[model samples]
Target: MADDFKVTDPRTLRAYAHPLRVRLIGLLRSEGPMTATRAAAALDDNVPNCSFHLRQLAKYGFAERVPGADARERPWRATARTTSWDDDSDDPAMRAATDQLNSVLLGVFTQRAQDYLATRADEPAEWRAAAGFGDMLVHVTAAELRELTEQIEALASRFDDRAADPAARPAGSRPIQLIQLAIPRGPVS
Candidate 1:
């Protein structure tokens, strides 16, 4: 899969802003390629519905069918490990599309967090200890904050290969979402 899918067109952004499509892309990224039927089973939805959304995703180049399979059973795979767009776009249309996509993503992230909390007690001690929320407040200029973001991204990229290569992951490893958010808590001084 490609490293990143950078969406610049507002139409494409709006197309990808749907919750189901977002979740489908996430599934493809985390679990590697799978047929629409399998994706539907994992997401607790129907094959026809999933297949439709997968086609929609493909319309904008977010996903593609894998080779070596017949039409009915061909697996669909994400074109990128991550989807990114400019939230700071000057174009109003672009900004609106970005906001819509972010809104859908935030809901997904929140639900995932809640799901983890609900099942935390049943998880292994090691996982429970390793997983939890964390936050930090810092004072920094825009340049410094940019630098910090780059640093964190670089560190995370170390594990990017593991997403596509199951063998690269060590034993007991599983897909983990690491969200990084750095926003101004108050107006700039």
Candidate 2:
């Protein structure tokens, strides 16, 4: 079984936000152990570039080279299930970087959604039913909001790990969009 993990530090978030670093982490988390070469192939990137980012991910404690895993076949996996940042910080640079990273990631997800929708015509019926796209507006307190976010993240992680299954996958077994929104009714005291 995979270990339970959490990251709630700004430094960790910054480290994991690097484009290649995040891609590598996602690759390992989804595909399991893999050599730098394999990771590169999975990401459609070069080995040296992937290796460099992998080392950076390790430096931030987001990942580690597996033991008994060959040095020549350096495989890595995420040390944490989630990475979070403290929004109360006053550091300008940290704030800017975090915002930028968030924006870029959002863009990535948007592109992925567009691509998925574009290919839906080619997808099979079972897959179309299994995968869905929708949004909801909910009213909740701060604590309730956080809990909702965590629940959604957990649900997404479950599906993300299912791609490795050998069972026959639905034709549209590709990615799906899951956007959640929780707007407060008024200003908090």
Candidate 3:
């Protein structure tokens, strides 16, 4: 599948705006390929629902069947290492759709974080120590914020290959969910 990071069409954005589809893409990306049944089990949803959403994600180029999987139990994987959308689309409809998609995504992210925090106590002490949670207010210029985002992206890309080759991952390297958000909290005083 051709991997286009920036989604420009409203229809595609709207298609991905669903909660299940968003989580499905995230699941595939993080945990590697899985059949609709496996994904459904992990998500606590029905197989048909998972299959339908996976197809919808595939329709928009977010995911595709793993090449070697059989017709009976096709495992789907993410088409790209990352999904990006243009928040500044020239088309009003697409722009509005993008905004709605972003809102949905923010809600999804919030849920993931909350779930993690709720279960964090059950995790081992090492993991508990390793986890991070902070909501600091930083002062920076627009260019500085851009650079910060770029630097954070670069830092996270260090694991882009781990999804493809589990052997390449160093021992004790565990998957860590990192969410970075930088929004202007009102105008600078």
Best candidate (score: TM-score):
1
List lDDT for all candidates, in order: 0.91, 0.70, 0.86
Better of 1 and 3 by TM-score: 1
- TM-scores vs. true structure, each candidate: 0.95, 0.71, 0.89
Report the C-alpha lDDT of model 2 over 153-189, residue by residue, as the tens digit.
Answer: 8877766544556364565355344655444666775
lDDT of 1 by residue, 78-156 (tens): 9998898887889999989998988888888888899899999999999999999999999999899989999998998
Scored by lDDT, the top model is 1
- Please list the residue runs of candidate 3 whose C-alpha ends up more than 4 Å from where it truly belongs after superposition: 1-4
Worst 10 contiguous positions by lDDT, candidate 3: 1-10
| Model 1 / residue 26 / CA error / Å | 1.1
Q: TM-score of predicted model 1? A: 0.95
Give lDDT for model 3: 0.86
